[model samples]
Target: MAERYEYLPHHLLRRRVRDVASGAEGELMAVVNENVSDTVVEHWVELAYIRGSSGREFSTSVDNIEPAVAI
Candidate 1:
């Protein structure tokens, strides 16, 4: 295993992530940009800024994405 991405800045760590809701295969992507502390969430949920391969950037809770293991 490489490393767990939780509890860290997205830009500072390897950004191979996948959209859990998309339900599509092969959507692994790298973080093109980030502002880990830029968003405010309910109940103090930490959000990460992510820019996917489609060039869509958004701030979302870490639960929305999962680390895409490299094979």
Candidate 2:
């Protein structure tokens, strides 16, 4: 059986998210699917922070991303 993946909507784009393992926070940029032979094998979430012209960006498994909690 294929695993189900949940994707965020356009309105949720740029929302803040945190990595469950690393505890790093960033803006949710996009969701990517890795396909093999017409089947999706993995799901990834692109994260980044923009400031002027320089910022850090990275991609990780969607399972690691979660909505950032306010404190």
Candidate 3:
């Protein structure tokens, strides 16, 4: 199953929805195990991206670990 996602920073203005769009509301999402091989493996990660704050952007990525978690 494909999931929809959106992000709202703490600095952004907050709003309330009064209607249902047949979807979800959150910055994180988890799609069902579709179009993926059962034998294939996957990992949860926080990819590096531009973070805009104080009128500046920085480059960063997940630190290298000796052993990745299995669970």
Candidate 4:
């Protein structure tokens, strides 16, 4: 099945693409997907940091790591 684009609003994602790339739309899309993956990982890392700071332990957990799969 095809993926839905609603998870990240198109306009916001478009802006992110502009912020991260200077290339064709197709190329930018690839970059955006990669960016989304990185962003998800970053969020998890940040959570871990927060938990550690609060005297709570947390393992690093990313929603998804596969490039072609949506979380």
Residue-wise lDDT of candidate 1 within 1-71, one digit each (tens)?
A: 22223455454244566556763223323332333343353123455555666666655555667776667
Whole-model Cα lDDT per candidate?
Answer: 0.48, 0.57, 0.24, 0.21
Q: Highest TM-score, which number?
A: 2
Candidate 2 lDDT: 0.57
RMSD of 4: 17.4
lDDT of 4: 0.21
Worst 10 residues of 2 by lDDT: 45-54
Using lDDT, rank the candidates from best to worst.
2, 1, 3, 4
The alpha-carbon RMSD values of the candidates against the true structure, listed in the order shown, are: 9.4, 6.6, 16.1, 17.4
TM-score of each: 0.41, 0.54, 0.20, 0.15
Per-residue alpha-carbon lDDT of candidate 4 for residues 3-49, written as tens digits (9 for 90 to 100): 32222222222121111121111111211111224333422121111
User: Lowest-lDDT window of 10 residues in candidate 1?
Assistant: 24-33
Give candidate 1 regions above 4 Å deviation: 1-12, 24-43, 69-71
